[model samples]
Structure formats: structure tokens, C-alpha cells
Target: MDLQAVVDSLPRYGEPLLTTIVVTVASAAFALVVAFALGLMTSSKHLAIRTPARAFVEFIRGSSAVVQLFWFAFAMPVLLGIQFDYLIAAGIIALGLNYGAYSSEVVRGAIAAVPKGQLEAATALNLTPLQKMRLVVLPQAWPEMIPSLCAFAIMLLKASALVSIIGVMDITALAGLIGSQAGQDRLVHYSVVLVMYFILAWLIWTGMRALERKAKRGLGVDVKPVKGRLAPEVAAGGVR
Candidate 1:
């Protein structure tokens, strides 16, 4: 492995790295919103609301994510008679739709796992449905949802590489370009790319861990920093 090739490729990665970061951030934000909306709809008392949300979740989850990207980038333009200038928006939509479907289940399960007694108490207090969710349910459920949502966010970051196929020049695409030209140093180039992805995922995980701790603290739960990490079972919501 020629370390020199890896060093040479690093400088050219700056622009592509920015593109990757933008796509990941935008897609994750979109996915989070979509996840919460669909998750909440799935729990609605109205069969009319729950049925379509559940169906969309299952449909997106069952299909291939790469195929979805292709549909947005290629098929949609042909069908709609519109062409995207950069293809960034289409990639973000594809990633958001794919991961959001999966993350919605995490949200649904977390919301459902909240103590039934709390729901009854909220009802007895004569709280409106929106108030019940905002003041009672979401505050409890959001913390429980964090870990799974973190996992999905990291998956979305790695999956952002899929956009390279549609010609968006993200880090992975640039790394592939470097590898092809580096002859015997292909291994070195790709090894660097692998490490770059790991670092990005690690950063996202660390951020989410902090968020979990903050959410627990908001509920007055004991949140001791255990060796630079949150203590296990902090989700149990043990009071200080």
C-alpha cells in the first residue's frame, strides 16, 4: 500500500467531503421529520390516518434503497419532464424516504412503550390530544427513540455513498475516482475512504449520545458521566 497515494488523494477530497456532509445533514433532518410525522400518524385513533401511513412505511421498507435513488434521479425526470440541475435534492429525498420509513418504526415503538398509566393520567387531566403528545408523551418517548434514530442516521450517512451512482460527486465518488487512477495503490486509497466514513459515523454517534443524556436530564433522571459515556440503562429514567 503506497501511503503517498493516500496522502495525495486527501487534498482533492475537500469539495467532495463538503458535498457528502451537506447531503447527510439535509437527508437526516428530512428523515427525522418524516419519521416523527409518520410515526405519530400510525398511532392516531383515526383508521383513515393510520392505514395510509402504515402502508407507505411497509412499501418503502420492502423496496430496495438503491432502486429508490434510481427512480428519483432517472425515472422521475423522464416521467415528469423535469431535470434536476445538481441531483443533490433527488438524492436527499431518496435517502430521506428510505431511512425515514425504517426510523418511523423506532418512533412508534418508543411512543408505545411509554407507561400506559401516563396516558390515562393525561386523559384524566382533560388535556387535548396535541397537548397530551407535546407535554406528556413526546418528552418521555424522544429519549427512548434516540439510540435507534442514531443508528439510522449513521446508516443514512454510509448510504449517502449510493448517490454517487447518480453522478453526485460526494467523498465516496471522489475516492473511487482516485482509486481507479492509482494502479497498485487502489487498496491504499480505498482504505482511507473506509476510515473517513468510520470517523463521520463516530461523530454522529457521539452527538446522539450527548442528546440522549440531555433528554434524560430534562426529565430529572440521574445522568452521571461514566468514563466519557452515558451509563447503561439510563433510559430507565431513575430520578436523581
Candidate 2:
């Protein structure tokens, strides 16, 4: 195999790889904001608030992300009468909205799973609704939600690949470009690209693990299961 050729060709793709990372990171951050906002909105006492939140979550989840990306890139500019740098915005919004729909459930589930006694205690303490959520409920739920959020972040990273189709020149795009110019076969180019993806994924996994441990530092002496696919444990520092 022309391994040396593949290795030598990699440096040229660095900028696009960075583009891919930027898209994924930016999307993940935006998705977290959307997920938490919509998730909490679902719990509102008023139907007006809850219904729309539920509808939006379901609507975004039900739709195809690729189609959404296309729309953001191709259709939104015309419909909204606003121009866009679709190359960037399309990937970010489409990935964020799509995954945010799924991750919202994680946020909701974590909040819902908090024991009833905790809520009652807050009520007994005369905590305001905002105060209770901010200080009492969320503190307990945050650890549980981290694993799921990280899972979505990983999924978002993979999904960001679609952005390349809209001319983002990300991994697949750069790989193909380099392969063509260097006269390398698919086996050589794609194999190298796959390794690059794994490296990025590993870095994210390790960082998330560290954050998980730090988040649980004050939970308690006993370990509690973090929800989602990761299934890690955090000590019950205090919240339980």
C-alpha cells in the first residue's frame, strides 16, 4: 500500500479537518442551548408553553437531517429573503436542530427522574420556581444528562460529514480532493480519513470523561449511575 503517499498527503487536508471540527463544536454548543431551553419548556405548568415545545421537538426529530441541511443551504435564503454563507450556517443549524431534538429528551428525562421528595423539599423550603430549578433540580440532573449529551455530541460529529456536500470541504471532501490530485486509490485516502475521525472521536471521549468526573465531585460518597450509553458512575456527593 502507498502508505507513505497517504501520510504525505494528509497535511494539505488539515484546514478542512479543522473546518469539520469547528462545525461539530459550534453545532454541539448551539444544540445544548436549544435542548435545555426546549426541554425545560416542556415542563411548564401552562399548556401554551408545553405544547409548542413538544411539537417543535417532535417535528425536528421526525424530519430528515439531510433535508434540513439542504433547506438551510438552498431554500432558506430565498424564503427568508436573507443571504447566507450556507457552507457554514447550513451545517451548524441543521446538525444543531436535529440533534437538539433528540438530546432534549435526555434533558427532560434527567429532570423528570429526580425523586419527588426532592421537589417537595424545595416546595417546603419555599423556593421560587426558578430558584428551585436552578439550585435544586438541575444540580441533581446535570450529571445524569452528561452521558447522553456527550453521546449526541459524538453523533453530531459524525453527522457533520453531510456538511461537506454543501461545499464545506470537510474530511470527505478534502480526502477526495487529495486522492484525486495525488493519484491515490479510495483505499488509501479513505483509510487515512477514517483514522483521523477516530483520533478526533477519542479526544472527545476522553475530554467528556474528565468533565463527567468533575461534574460529580460533590454529589456524595455513594456512586450513582450516569444515564445514556456511557453508563459511568459518579459518587453521591450530596444531591443524591
Candidate 3:
């Protein structure tokens, strides 16, 4: 690969990279909030409250995210007679709904993983249902939910690339533009964008790993330290 050629190709992609990052971060935050709300609603004891939330989650999960994106971009305005920026609306609706469904499952699993004994103990203490969830269950569940949440966030980030289909000019779109401009150097141009995405994904993974370690520590879970082993002489000295 001609390294200089790839370097030269990067400027054309800068805007697209920025657009992708912004959409990913914004959409993931929105999705997290939506997921938490809907997930809780789905777990509600009242059939009226739970049924719709459960159905929504199931429907979103069963559908194709790309198809949803296309619907939002093309069909929504016609159906509702309201216009929105294609990229912004797509980011908000597609990612928020798609990841929200996945997050509902994560939340449900986390809540289920909370031991029945804990709920009983809370009830024995005369705690309200809300109190039990707030004080006893969610604290435990949030940490457990982190790994899954991180995975969902990564998926959302990659899926944000699909916004390019509607001419959103996200990272993938920028790569396509660079490929067109570079002609025979298309391979080098696209390679740079690929490497950039790989690096971004790696950084996200590393950050999530650090967050998981911190959460484990906060929860008083034993995390084995990576360090030098204690010598037998030192152990004997301490025992003495």
C-alpha cells in the first residue's frame, strides 16, 4: 500500500467520520434512555402497562433495522405529513428503536437474575415495589447489565454506518466519495476508512473493559490483580 496515498485520501473522509461519530453518540444516548424506560414498563406487573411495551420490543427486535431506517427516511413523512432531516430522523428513530429492543432484553435478564430471596427480603422489610427496585434490585442489575449495554452500543455504532444509504454522508459515505475521487487508488482510500473504524471500535472496546473492571470492583467482586507473586519468604515473614 502507498502510505502517502492513503494519507492524502483521509481529508475527504474527515467530515463523514465526524458525522458518524456524532450520530452514533447521540443515538446511543437516546436509545439508552428509551430502552431503560420501555424495559421497565415491559417488566411492570400490570398487564395493561406491560403488554404494549412487550409488543413494541418484540416487534422492533423481529424487524430488520435497515428496513426500519428506510421506512423512517422515506415513508414516515408521507404517513404523518411531518418532515425531518433524513439523517437526524433516521439516527433518532432507527437506532433508538433498534437498540432499545435489545436493551429491553438485557434489562429483563438482569432483573430476572436478581435473586428471589432479595425481593422477599425487601418485602419482609416492608419495602414498596418501587423501593425494592430502586434500592435493592437496580444497583445490582446495572452492573450486570454493563457488558450487554457495551455490546449494544458497539452494534449501534456500526449500524450508524447505514445512515449513509439515505445520503447522510456518514463515515461509510465518505469512504465511498473518496473511492470515487481516487479512481484506481480506491483500494487505498477505502482502506484508510476501514482502519479508522477498526481503531475507533478498539478504543470503545477498551473503554468498556475498563468500565466493567471498575463496576466489578465497586460491587465488591474479586478481580484478580496482575502483578508479581508474593515470595515464600515474604509470606513466611508476614505469618511470623
- Which candidate has the highest lDDT of all? 1
The candidate scoring highest on TM-score is 1
lDDT at residue 63 of model 1 (Cα atoms)? 99
Q: Give the per-residue Cα lDDT of candidate 2 at 134.
A: 93
Each prediction's whole-model lDDT (CA): 0.90, 0.85, 0.81
TM-score of 1: 0.90
lDDT of 1 by residue, 154-207 (tens): 999999999999999988888778887834366666777798899999999999
Q: TM per model?
A: 0.90, 0.89, 0.87
**lDDT value for candidate 3?**
0.81
lDDT of 2 by residue, 111-163 (tens): 99999999999999999999999998998999899888887888888888899
- Per-candidate clashes, comma-separated: 0, 7, 0
Worst 10 residues of 2 by lDDT: 229-238
Worst 10 contiguous positions by lDDT, candidate 3 = 180-189
